[model samples]
Target: MVLTDTHTHLYYETDAEKQDLLFQRCFENKVNRLFLPNVDVSSIAKIDALVEKYPDNCFAMAGLHPCDVKEDYEILLKEIYQSMAGKKIYAIGEIGIDLYWDKSTLDIQQTAFREQIKWAKAAKLPIVIHCREAFDEVFEILEEEKADDLRGILHCFTGNLEQANHAIALGFYLGIGGVVTYKKAGLDEVLSHISLDNLVLETDSPYLAPVPFRGKPNESSYLVYIAQKVADIYHISIEEVAAITTANSKKIFNV
Candidate 1:
């Protein structure tokens, strides 16, 4: 069973030994493909290097993350946009409003999100949205920019059914991750109403690790646990979850 981790930060690992072990674990778990999202200018080199080294397994995306948005975001975004030229980026992502960290940068974050959406449309690529504590803000921007050509995933979706339906209605897939395994997350109820075709799996790792490994550093290898949780939620088999979500990832990333 081939599994795809639609969002992971393998580039964040600095230790060669641990990185190799992580990749080995991922392969052992049949989580072969990993899509790495860009955070800011500092992440470019590491992202590029990871993709270059594991050209077959790793793919890179270019975008300024919402949390990274600052007063001089214009300059940072310019460099990110320029780097996308003739590059092998899968999407313009991990971008959106992030009020959780700093609400002061909301204006700049929205501007960056709008601009990056334009870039994604111009490049004919999917976008991996990173919405956090700003679904309304993100929806507003998406409403203005929505079109038949626009497509992407709402990475790490943890919203109510109304918001979930809204995102699906906009021709975007909901990216399910480790949070689904949490008992009180209420994601299972949300998943019960959403179709499997409109869903995709992600780890958002070295971040949201599944239960049993919760609060620990996450990895792509743990995607199986998330998939299992999704299967249970849907009353389906883990194999079916793997097949469907992998297909969904391919549909979005075109990889």
Candidate 2:
């Protein structure tokens, strides 16, 4: 069964040996497909190099993360957009409002989010959103910017059923990750009501590791654990979960 980690920061591992080990572990777990999200200008080349090194496994995306938005965000956006000049990007994202980190940057964050949505629309690409403690803010923008091509993944979704339906209505896949494995997270219950068709799997790695490795640094390989948890939620085989979620990822990334 082939699995895909639709949103991961594996490029953060600059150590060559450690990167090889991580990819090896992912291969062993059948998590061979991975997509990298750009957080800031610094992450662009790292993501590019990783994709270049493993062209068959890793893919790239460009966007300024909500938390990274600042006074000079427009300049940052220009730089990020320029980085896509000769690159094959699967999405214009990992972008959206993030109220968890800093409430002060909400305005700029919203601006960045909308701008990136426009970028995606113009390029005919899907977006991979990063929403944290700002569902209303994120939804407001998504609703305003709704269009036939404004579709993507709501990365790291930990919302309730109503919100899930809201996102689905707005054309997005709920990206399930490690949070679903935490007994107290309640994401499993929410996901049980969500169809596999509107869902995708991700690790968001180097963060949110699943149970058996909870509280530890996450990796794409542990995507298997997240996949297994989803399998249990729906009483389906892990292979079925892999096939469905990986297919969902392919639908979004067109890979």
Candidate 3:
């Protein structure tokens, strides 16, 4: 069963030894493809290096994260726009309004989000969103920016059935991650009404580890656990989950 981690920050680990070991475990578990989302200018080098090292396994995205949106966000956005020129970025993402960390930056965050959405559409690529306690804001922008060419994943989706359907209606796939394994997350129920075709698997690794490994650093290798949990929730085989989600990933990334 080949599994795809549609969203993961492999650049979070700087140690070569740890990186090697983590990737080795991922390979062993059939978690072959790891999509790395750009946080900011500082993370670009690490992300580029990882994609260079594992050209076949790692894919890179170019975008300014919402949390990283500060007063001087225009400068960062300019850099992001320049980086996207003639470069092989798989998506424009991990971008959206993150109200949890700093509500003060909401205005700029929405501006960044809309601009990045324009970038994604211009590049004719998919977007990977990172919405945190700003579903209404995110959905409003998506509604305004809705178009035939606009499509992507709602990364780390933990919303209710209505939200799930809304995202699906807006041409997005729900990114199912380690949160689904949480005891009281209720994601299992929310997922029950959704179809596998509109879902993708992810780890958001180095964070949000599954049940057995919760509170610890998450890894791509732990994707199997998330897949197993998803399989259980859908009453489908883990292999089926892997196959469907992997196909969904390939469809979005065109890889």
Off by over 4 Å in 3: none
Residue-level lDDT of model 3, residues 1-255, one tens digit each, is 899999998888999999999999999999999999998998888988998899999999999999999999999999978877665899998899898889999999999999999999988999999999999999999999999999999999999999999999999999999999998999999998899999999999989999899999999999999999999999999999999999999999999
Per-residue C-alpha lDDT of model 2 across residues 134-241, encoded as one tens digit per residue: 999999999899999889999999999999999999999999999999999898888878899999999999999999999999999999999999999999999999
Prediction 3 global C-alpha lDDT: 0.94
Q: Which of the two, 1 or 3, has more lDDT?
A: 3
Q: What's the CA error at residue 242 for candidate 2, in Å?
A: 0.6
lDDT, residue 178, candidate 3: 97
Q: Give the CA lDDT, 0 to 100, for residue 139 in model 1.
A: 97
Model 1, 70-184: lDDT tens per residue?
9889999999888877778999988998899899888889889999999999988999999999999999999999998899999999999999999999999999999999999
What are the models' TM-scores? 0.98, 0.99, 0.99
Alpha carbon lDDT of residue 108, candidate 3?
Answer: 92
User: After aligning candidate 1 to the native by TM-score, how far in Å is the CA of 195 from where it should be?
Assistant: 0.6
What is the TM-score (0 to 1) of candidate 1?
0.98
List the global CA lDDT of all models. Answer: 0.93, 0.93, 0.94
